[model samples]
Target: MVAPLSAWPWENLGCFKYLLYGPFLAKVLYSRFHDQEASEYSWCLHILVICALRGLIHQIWSSYSNMLFLKRNFRIIEHGVDFKQIDKEWDWDNFIILQALIASMASYMFPFPANLPFWNTKGFIAVLTLHMAVSEPLYYLMHRYVLHGNSFFTHHHSLHHSSPVPQPFTAGLATFSEHLMLAVIIGIPILGASLMGYGSIITIYSYVLIFDFLRCLGHCNVEVVPYQIFKTIPFLRYLLYTPTYHSLHHTEMGTNFCLFMPLFDAIWKTLNGKSWELHKKIRSNLGKSGRVPDFVFLAHVVDVSAALHAPFVFRSFAALPFSPRFFIIPLWPLTLLALLMMWAWSKTFVYSFYKLTGRLHQTWVVPRFGFQYFLPFAREGINKHIEQAILRADKLGIKVISLAALNKNEALNGGGTLFVDKHPNLNVRVVHGNTLTAAVILNDLPKNVEEVFLTGATSKLGRAIALYLCRKRVRVLMLTLSAERFQKIQKEAPVDCQNYLVQVTKYQAAQNCKTWIVGKWITPREQSWAPPGTHFHQFVVPPIFSFRRDCTYGDLAAMRLPDDVQGLGCCEYTMARGVVHACHAGGVVHLLEGWTHHEVGAIDVDRIDLVWNAALKHGLRPVSSSC
Candidate 1:
């Protein structure tokens, strides 16, 4: 629930909310352009840099803490963050915006130190002493009494507490009034130092950076601070708070209301008794191995910008269907830098996870992109990554590992056939997930249809779809130039049904066929040959565009996860909420069914209906696509 207080006016702007700094940015740029003295725009530039740095700090902590490879065992809360939490905390950086705006205004109203030196030992000491004396207690008092005890403040502060599993940005997720109070608490020491003629640029930067750093650290949900220090110096526990310490506040609302220091909590006898014990307990388990997921979706990055859609990078962005955002264009440099780094030193990593029916499901990414898969030289490297991932999953005793998108490319690794062939003794099931993919596409076709046009006629999915349709006595116009491959697939069908599969090499052959099954991308000219109202069913990667207005296009094969799925905070590429590509769902079905066979290489045409039925049996529903 939203606080009764009014929200930030620019809340709906989403990414454009940063434009609130336009006036300050313009003033800084204009002042610099006019060749003014350093003091004229330096402070404004400082405020901008500080705010950006604060955001960067939060991003770094978020990335690190969410990295299961790094700190999975150390997680205080094992449950995944859901879409509701993500939507609520979408504007986690609102406090930074508020801080920038207030600081910019205060620069004009108050007489800040001008032409300040880089370092001032006296100023640094003064700020620290003043924070300990004034800021800490005042914040604790307001947070404990007003925020918790009063009705209005309680309503707003509840927003922050809503996120039971605190993330790095969760520290800043609050209402305008709460942030305003916080700004005052944080500002008191800096303003006090300036008034006492002890302020320096270094003091302001150092103090604020530490403040932001500690805030992020406390909310990171991982126990990074060593308990040894606290063990040695018991007094230090009162002076500082750990991630586990603050997490208790969110879970147990009435206790541990101190800002960054536990001293006040102890003073007021409000500290939770479990804070230190829980901190030590979580820290002790940090070195142990993490739990293995029941199912793993081996996925690959699509492109540079889409990398940001990884749940760890941007929770809110990943929750929605992915599309290129103009606002994300500015961050291309950082993503590009990350891309280059991954290209140089990338490995398969756990990208996200969730739970369904008591089973843990994880999505792992092979740091290669879609374009990289097409490169001849990168094929071996990509396969090596996939192979290693399969081996790791096998070692971890994972029940099923599903290959998604290009990860199961026949040309690259024979749809994950290479690994299964070489490691025949492997215990883990390597599933291409194409059986269900074919099922979803073929099932969507009208049963009354007498004929259908097929492209990529000899591909694994195309072969399965054509053979399945042939068994139903549907005349299939298989579009292929290679007669040998077509003949081979035709020979596999029943003798009586074989005549239904006919080879057609040209797009003109499909002009009269209204039901077109596209497994390969076709050009506008080729698409033009289709008759008006032709419904195209596809299982193509980077699904084809709807070039003809007279015809309709279908999305790639996908299925909606069961309603009981938990912690499903991110979408699977362009799929809608709770919907996942059929291949991914295929793996889930495999796990739920406890299927023992390795579902790699060629898809089993006979099992299409069985798998489809099994999916329905387990409550997985096909994602209905119009047109």
Candidate 2:
């Protein structure tokens, strides 16, 4: 809850912040902007270079400092943890370069203020001071009224708040409109300064760099600055925006609005009293750092080959008495071997993976894991193994993880709800990766097909696909486990889609519908039910190892990807290039595109093209778009 403005610790210090920061920051920013003579490109280059430097301060220095603070001072609470990884999908590939490129374009189109030497040395300082001097009102209004106010949060701004715990670069997770609005907000002071003849080489560089780094620093959950620092300079409480202060806004939105200073919050009476205390409490319990996967794939294996040999194990156990002593002894070795094989096969571990290296520093942050993807049928052990893997990833600061195809079903009946239900303490997100699958299918649906038949329609992937199709008025003959299940799933489809959707309890009921896709492996009977000339695609895992005449096994393989984008068996990329499954590919696309939420059983239809295009550049073909 927020407190009264007069009750704020720094309320009386508003005058002090304006008085002190006015000239202090102005003098430092003046020489940088006014003294140097530079071309527009040089000015852009200066911004680009300073941005790199600020990145170091934000990502490396402050991150390391935050880590140290967590290590030294932060301790874990009973139900809470400190330095729990925030979902960070930002780097040159995902966000920074994109933002920089856009900024560069904007700057090139509308040049920055490159004014002459100050008529008076302190003359330009006033303009720079005036720029900051006006910050109190505008920053507060944009953040409070426009961002958190109403529908703005629902549509544009709240996307940034989607990640409860934000990382330094997670700040880039806003809607395109929000990002554009922010560019305007940040340029306000500088634009005003430019008008007053305060624009110089360093002015643009310092304002852009300092503003960028500070915004990132504020979001960094690591509270590196000791409370003593605040005591040392009590006035800083009013002037400087702390990491803890910004964190409060994310945790409980609407408290702190001013990006650079806290006095505005004090003046507006929207200050959070819990910010400093929670920060202190959280950091006190920081845990030790360790290696974690970029994602954790829940897994199990059904030995297609091993199942044939399984009768031996049961036969031996049934004949435990050994009617003939010699034969019984012989059977013992086979039983032991079978038990060993079964035990060995069921064990879980970090399986094959490919790493995406950072472009700027080659930082090894996103190491995508395949994690037991080749296995299936682990109900008894799946939960334990999945939990263990998530914990392991959390220890290493891995913010996001996900379950693979079969594992996803085993975990939550193919939904994220179960993970939240079972493991509430986990700070990590369990991405289902099905959202983009539906998107991919919908995006690439054959234009000639008026109706699509979907078998196993009650499963998460199938159900999601049905909803997406029905929304587009595509007729679906949906087959499910039972009439009850079919109706339940059908209820979720758009009411207007009754004419467009049909429910089928058996494969026989859907045969006439030409185009067919099975979200799960169908029984041999279902396969036999396929009519001649029907276009069929199998969208499940541990795929039908052999291709059928009318069926495409595995969505990615069905797409007939380009050489560089095809999988080499398991989820591991060949030469660490190409994507394994379309679901996994979708996850990578989300990260590279800087999406805020995890792509689960549902995806936005608009993003399908974007993910598809990204996959194409890396060698994936557009086969799905064709017949």
RMSD of each: 2.5, 21.8
Error of 2 at 181 (Å): 70
In candidate 2, residue 220 scores what lDDT? 57
Q: Model 2 lDDT vs. the true structure?
A: 0.53
Clashing pairs in 1: none
Tens-place lDDT digits, model 1, residues 1-627: 665553776787988988888887887899989999877888788988898899889988888877876687889888888788888887889999899888888888765545566778898989999999999999998988888876855678777888868999798888888889999999999988887778898899889999999999999989999999999999999999999999888888889998899999998999999999889888998545567899999998999889988877777788999999987899899998987887778778888899999899999988887898999999888888899999999999999999998999999999888999999999999998999999999889987999999999899999999999999999999999999999999999999999999999999988889999999988888898999999999987778887988888988899999889998889988998899999999999999999999998898988999999999999999888422
- Segments of candidate 2 deviating more than 4 angstroms: 1-348, 357-380, 410-416, 523-525, 542-577, 596-627
Candidate 1 lands at a TM-score of: 0.93
Best by lDDT: 1
- For model 2, give the RMSD to the true fold: 21.8
Top model by TM-score, which number?
1
Clashes of 1: 0
